[model samples]
Target: MLTPRWILLNRRKLGPITAVAGIVVLVIFLGSAFFSGPSQSQLDKQKSFTTALDNTFASRSFRFEVESKLLGENGFYSKVEGERVMPDKVHIKGTVLKTPVEFTQVNENTYMKDPFSGKWLTLKDIKLSQSELFITELNPLANFNFKDIPEIEMVGEEDLDEDKCYVYELKPNVVNAFLEEQFSDFYYKVWVDQKDVNIRQAIIKANRPESGNSGLDMKIRIWDYDRDLQIDAPVKASTTTQENVPY
Candidate 1:
């Protein structure tokens, strides 16, 4: 009788012990499932969301900062700050080969102020060199189109500044002819805000033709969307005609 009673008591304890062990196993499984990284399907959804945002972003005003570096014997690094308003107005201030250059565009006309001369010249009034013209065309935000990309994929999610963004790696079917002439095998990575669909940051990398496999990289950051920016032409007293400077 004593042996039977002991066995029954042990059986009663085993039930609760097994139940607790089962619950512990279930909690661990649930945690692992919840903490797993995003899947391919999730990445695809993010890519689609970003594509839609890029298509419509230029309709508003924004500010941008660009950091450029050329890797090779003739390597150089420069920083550019730009502001733009919708329709057609832009201002860019930056350095090229350590020389400061500032330019503004309102409608079809562009004005450039020389760093050394401290004088401003209008694009319409002057014969611009290829390099100067190229600088004027550097509108990274408006110049790009989602349709131009051949391949794009979500790399991961990252925090840009204080905003959470989805990072994407992109390869274009063709780059701008002028850019292609200077650099080969170019690629881009962009960070898009998860909440607002705004582009938070972008990076462009390419190999210089003259430097063999040496590369050039440019990091672009966009912010201050729809903020008020006061852009105006240079004062008439400081303006210089094109003929004053030799091209």
Candidate 2:
């Protein structure tokens, strides 16, 4: 029993309401597209940063002096001093002090040299590829290739000591089968300096099933960096192990 006039009136009211709703939706979509994700310029910048890191790693070779403190289960502590030469060579000479055991890395090999016994005990190979190091070092920088990475998002900005930095959170990228198995359920959070595009901090949590160390967490902090020398050296590095014994 509705009149044509009533129908027209209802249509007019609905039209305006629908138009406003559509405008609101469009605004929201545009806002999310613009503000919620990285801009095109940012993506390009990331690609450039990644390429720079790749070139840096490929072209440069340098010496590194590293000092690290390893914390074991049940609150035991061991300090180590290491010197590494790039192009697949490292030498670490240090003592646990408490256990009086010496650890050393010659070439790509890692060993525990016993002072008491005067014998060298060879350990597992500390293997790292040039490409792997390139990717690992570069991925922290802003505007780096991130489409291939999953669950990786810009966390925020941070002030690391005196340096201002950008923080990013990285989770396992399942599409990469090698990475999926290698970094299962792991979170790699990196902090990169704004000015130099150098990584300031890297925290990694990994699962090692074959070694019986299922849950492993470690942090590497590059307290100082030299772009002139093209080295991202860690002034301080620390590792936490579930086992009470030093490996």
Residue-by-residue lDDT tens digits, candidate 1, 1-247: 8999999999999999999999999999888877895667876756665564654464478888878887887787788888877756778888877889787776655688878778877765432322333442346553244346667778888998889888888776443555666777668888887777877788888887676757878888888888888777667525555555545
Q: Rate residue 33 of model 1 by lDDT.
A: 75
TM-score of model number 1: 0.70
lDDT of 2 at 47: 53
The TM-score of predicted model 2 comes to: 0.50
Query: When superposed on Cα atoms, how far off is each prediction in RMSD?
Result: 7.0, 10.0
- Return the clash pairs for model 2, or none: 46-143, 46-144
Q: Which candidate wins on TM-score?
A: 1
Q: What is the lDDT of residue 131 in candidate 1?
A: 37
- List ranges where model 2 is wrong by over 4 Å: 1-37, 41-81, 93-148, 172-183, 208-214, 223-247
How do the predictions measure up, each by TM-score?
0.70, 0.50
